[model samples]
Target: MENLPYGALAALVGLSGGLVLGLAARLGDFCTLGALESSIYGGDHRRLRLWGIVLGTAIAGCYLAQAAGYIDLSQTLYQSVRWNPWASIVGGLVFGYGMALAGNCGFGALARFGGGDLRSLVVVVVMAVFSFITLNGPLAPLRITLFPQIGAESSQNYADLISGLTGLPPLAIALPVAVLCFAWALSYAPLRRSPRRLVWGLLAGLAVVWAFVGTAWLADQSFGEVAIEGPSFTAPLGRTLIYLMTSTAGGITFSVGSVIGVMAGAFIGSSIRGLFRWEACEDPRELGRQVTGAALMGIGGVVALGCSVGQGVSAFATLAYSGPVTLACIGAGAVLGLRHLIGGFQPG
Candidate 1:
C-alpha cells in the first residue's frame, strides 16, 4: 500500500477477486443464465437460491463495509449515475436477450474461453469490440441522447433515499433486507443440501466486497485516478482488448487484472476438473447468431451502464435502485428469448 504503484495494487485487487469468481463459475457452477434457466424451466430452486445467497451476502458485506467506513457508495458508478428506470429496463432487456442468444454473457464467455471453448473466444472478441463502439465510438452519441445520465440530488443510492424518507439510518434498511434474503435462500431445502454451492456463493459475493474495499482504500490513500468500482465485465472487456493490442498505451488496472485472473482461474479449475477441451461452433448459422448476440450485449451493457455481473451483483451490493429492477428485466427478457428458441419461434 505504501510502496506499491497504484496500477499494480489495483491489478492485484482485481486478480484476487477474479480468482474467486472464476472458481465459483467452474467449481460451483454459479452462473446467471444457468440460474435463470433452471428456475424458469427445470423446476430447480437451488441455482436461483444460490444467486440469492450471493446477492444477500454482497448486500450485507457492502453495507457492513460502509458501516466500518471502508468504502463509500456515493463514489460508485451505480450511485453516481442518475436513476434511469426506463433505461435500466430497456437496457437490461436488450442485454439479457442478447445474452440468451449468445448462450453466455461477457463474464461467462470469458470463463468459457478460459476453459478451452473456442466459440466463446469469438463471442468475447465481438462483445468487447462492440462494447467499445458504444462506449466511445459511433454509438456513444445515440446512447447519450437516448439515456442521458445525471447525478442524484439528495441521496447517493436507494438505501439513502429510503433512509431519508423513513428517517432511519441507511444500514437500518440495508441490513434487514440482506438478512431476509439470506434467510430465504437458506430456507430452501435443496440449496441447504448443497453446502458447496452456498460456500461458493458466499465467496463470489465476498469477492465483490474485496474489490470495492481494496480499491476504495487505495483511492483514499493514494494520489491517482482511482475510481471506486467493483467487478464489471462490459467496458472492461473493451479496455482489456485494447490493452492487448497496445501494451504500453493502456497500463495495468483492476479491469485488466480481473479479466486475466478469471481466465487463469478458470483454466486452472478446468484442468483440475478434467474438463479442459477445445470446442468451436459447428455451424456458421450458430456463429452468426452468437455474433449478433455479442454485439447487442455490448451496446446494451453500455446503455444500461453494466452487465449481469456488474448490475446484478456489484450494483445490488450497493442497494442501488437500478440493480433489482434491471436484474428482473434481464430475467424477463431471457425468459422471452429462451421461450422463443424453445418454441421454434412460435407466438407465446
Candidate 2:
C-alpha cells in the first residue's frame, strides 16, 4: 500500500466499484434506457422498478457513511458545483434523446463493448471523442458561456437544504427518503419475486457508496492530491482515452480504472451468461444514427456534468439537486426520442 502511488490507489477503488456496477448492469439488466423502454413500450415495469432498490440502497449507504465520518459529500462535484437548472434540463434532454438513438449511454456502451459488441465500440469511441470536444475542445467555450459552472457557496443537496428548513440533521431526512424508495421498489410483485435482481440492485447502490468512501479516504491520505469522486462515465470516458493514448503523459487515475473495470466486469458477466459474441453494425444508416447520437451524448453529458449512471445513480446517492432533475429530464427526452423513432410522431 505504501509503495503504490495515490493515483493507483484511487484507480483501484474505482475499479472495485465499477466492476460491481458492470456486473449489475449485465447480470441484473439494470440499464437506464432499457428500463424506460421496457416500462413505457414493452409493458414491463420490473426493470424500471429496480431503480428504486438501487437508489434506496445508495441513499441509505451514503448517508450512513456520512454519519460515520467515512466520507464528505461536499467534496463531490455534484455538491461543489453551483446548481444549474437550465443546464440540467437542456443537457439531460439532449443526452436522453441521444441515448435513444444510440441505444446506449456511455456506461452501457462500455458494458456492451465488453460483451463483444463491436458496434458499441464505435459508440464508445465517438462518445469519448465528442465528450472531449465539448469538455475541453471547440464547444467548451460555448458550453461555458451558456452554462457557467461556478463553485457553490456551500454544499448543495436535498438533505442539506431540507435540514436547513426543518432544523434537523441531514440523516434525519435521508433515511426516510431511502426507505420510501425501497418501499416503492418492493411494491412491485414481479421485482419482489426476483431476488437475484434485488441483490444486484443493492450491490449496484453499494458500489456508489464504495466509490465515495474509497476516494474520500484516498483524498485524505494523499493530502488532497487525490480527488473525491464517484463513477461518472462521460468525462471519464474521454479521460480513459487520453490515458490510453498517452500513458507516459497521463498517469493512472480513477477514471481510467473505472472505464477498464466496467469493460472487464461486463466481459465476465457476458461469459457467464454465454452471451459473448462478436457483433457489428451491418447497416450504414444505423451506424450513422449511432455516431450522431454518440456525439450528442458526449456534448450533453459534458454540459450536464454527468451521464445517466453518473447523475442518475452516483449523484442521486448523494442527494444532490442535479441528480433527480437531470434524471427526470433524461427520461422525458428518452421518451420523446423513442416516440419519434417508433413513428409515434406520425401526425398523432
Candidate 3:
C-alpha cells in the first residue's frame, strides 16, 4: 500500500465509498432535504431517524478507528481548521435556504443528476463554479480576511475537549454518545421495520470512517497530496471540474474519485430500479430559481467549510465543534425556507 501512488490510492478509496453513498441515495432515498420535508410536512420520522443512524454510526466508527490507531483525527482538515461560529451560522443558513430553492444540496444534486435529472446538472455546475470562486478565486481574499481559518488555540475536537476536561480517554466519552444516538435511531419502530434503510444508513456512516482510515494510511505511508479526509462535495466538485478541463496539469484525487463514484453508483442504482430516464427543466422561472439557489449553495458551502453531508455527517464523525452548530443552523434555515414556500412566510 505504501508503494502505491498516493493520489491513485486515495481516489480508489474515495470511489469505493462514494459508490456506497450513491446507491444509498438512489435506492434507499437517503437525502437531507427529503428527510427534512418528510419529517416536517409529511408527518413522517423514518427518514430523519435514518439520518440519525448514519450520524451515530459515523461517530462510533470514527472514534473506534482512532482508538485502534487506524486514523489520526488531528491530521484531518476538520480538526485542523479553526471553528468559526459566525461562519458556520451564516454559511449554514445560506446553504440551507439554497437547498430549499434548488430542491437539493450539492450531494443531492449529484445523486439526482446520476438518476437522469438533467436539471440537476445545472445546479451541480453552478454550485461547483461558485464554490471555486469562494474557495480560491477572487472571493478567497475577502473570505480569509473575514473568517480567518486558523487552527484552534485549544484543541477544537470534542473528543479532545472531553478527554482534557474529565481526564477520560476521548474514546470513552465518544462511544457512549454514539451508542445513545444509535439507540434512539433504533427506538423508532418504523425505521427498524425497514431494514433496507437501516442498512444503507449504517453503510453511509461506515463510508466516512473508511475514507479517513484509508487516507490516513496513505499519508502515513507516503507524505504527499494525501490528506486525511472523508466525503465532501462542495470544493471537491469544483476541483473535479477543473481536473476535467486540465487533465495534463491536474492529478486525480480523492475528491475527483468521490464525485465520479457517486454519479456512477447512482447510475447503477437507478438502472437497477428501472428509474433511469432523461428529464429537463421546461420552465424558465424554475430554472432561474435553481441557478440562484445553486450559486448560494456554492458560496455558502465554501464559507461554511462544508455542505450538509460535509459538516453534518463527515465533520460530525470527527466530533468537531462546527458540525452540530452548523447543522442546527442549516436545519433552522431549512425550516424557515420551507415555511416561506408552503405558506408565503405569513405568520398566524
Candidate 4:
C-alpha cells in the first residue's frame, strides 16, 4: 500500500464506495426522481420512506465516526465552504427541474447507462461536458460573479451551530436526529416489510461514511494532496471524462474511480437482476429535451456545488446548513417540473 501512488489509493477508496452505492441503486431501488415520482403519482411511499433509512443511517454513521475521531467533518466542502442560501435555493431548483426533464440525475444517469441504456449514455456525456463548461468553461465567470464560493471561517453546519448554542457535543445533537429519521422510516409498514430495501439503504449510508473516512485519512497522509470528499456525481463525472481523454496530462483520482465504479457496479447489479438490456432513444424530440435538461443540471450542480447525492446524502450526513434547504428546493422544483410535464403546462 505504501508503494502505490496516493491518487491510486484514493481511487480505490472511491471505487469501493461507489460500487456499494451503485448496487444500492439497482438492487434496492434507491433513487431521487423515482422516489418523488412514485410517491406523488404512483401512490407508493415505500421508496420515499427508504430515504429516511438512508439518511438516518448516514447521519448516525458519519457523526459517530466523527465523534470517534475517525474523520473530520470540518474538512469536507459542505462545512468548509461558506453557506449560501440563495445558491442552494436557486441551483437546487434548476437542477431538480432538469432532473425531471432528463428523467434522472447525474448519478442516476450513470447507473442507467451501466444498465446498457444508450440514451443514458447521452445524458451522461452531455451532463459531464456541460458541468465542465459551467465549472471552468465559458459560464464559469458569470457563475462565480453570481455565487462566489469563498471559504468559511469555521465549519458551517447545523451540528456545529447547535453544539455551540447548547454547549453540547455535536454528536449529542446528531443522535436524536438520526433516531427520528429511523423512526420515520420504520413507521411505514411496507418499508419495514422489505428487508432487502432496508439492508441496502443501510449499506448506501455506510458507503458515504466510508468515502469521508477513507479520504480524510488519505488527505492527512498526503498532506492535502487528496481532497476530503464523498460521492458527488457532477464535477466528478467531468473529471472522469477528462482523465479518459487526457490520462497523460492528469492522474487518476477518487472522482475518476467513483464514476467508473458506478457504471461497473450498475452493470453487475443489472446482470444479476436480468435487467441489462440495450436501450436507445428513438425520438429526436425526447433526445433534445434530455440534452437540454442535462445542460441545466450541469449548470445548476456547479452553482450548488453538488448533485442530488452530493447535497442530499453526503452534505446531509454532515448536517450542513445547505443540505436540507437545497434538498427541499430540489424537491419543490421537481414537483413543479413533474406537474408541468403531466399537465402540459395547462391550468388546473
TM-score of each: 0.96, 0.98, 0.96, 0.98
Q: What TM-score does prediction 1 earn?
A: 0.96
User: Whole-model Cα lDDT per candidate?
Assistant: 0.87, 0.91, 0.88, 0.91
Per-residue lDDT of model 4, residues 1-348, tens digit only: 899998999999999999998998899989999999999999999899999999999999999999999999999999999999999999999999888888899999999988999998888899999999998999999999999999999879998899899999999999999999999999999999999999999999999999999999999999999999989998888989989998843589989888888888899999999999999999887888789888888988888889899999999999999999888888888888888878764222
Clashing pairs in 3: none
User: Which portions of model 2 miss their true places by more than 4 Å?
Assistant: 248-250, 344-348
| lDDT per residue as tens, model 1, 1-348 | 668778778889999899989988887788888888888889997988888889889999999999999998878899877879988899899999888888899989988988999999998899999999998899889888999988777565778888888999888899898888899899999999999899999999999999999899888877537778899888899988888888754687889989888888888878889999999899887888789888888988888889999998899899988899888888887788788778775221
Give the range of the ten consecutive residues with the poorest summed lDDT in model 2: 339-348
| Candidate 4 residue runs with Cα over 4 Å from true position | 345-348
Tell me how far the alpha carbon of residue 151 in candidate 4 is from the true structure, in angstroms, after superposition.
0.7
Candidate 3 residue-wise lDDT, 1-348, digit = tens: 657678888999999999999998988889999999999889988988888889899999998999999988877878888889999999999999888888899899999999999999999999999999998899999999988898756677888998998999989988888988888889999999999999989999998899989899888877646888889999899988988899733588899989999999899989999999999999887788788888888988999999999999999889999898888888887777777767753222
How many clashing residue pairs, candidate 1? 0
TM-score of model number 3: 0.96
Would you list the clashing residue pairs of candidate 4?
A: none
Error of 1 at 149 (Å): 2.1
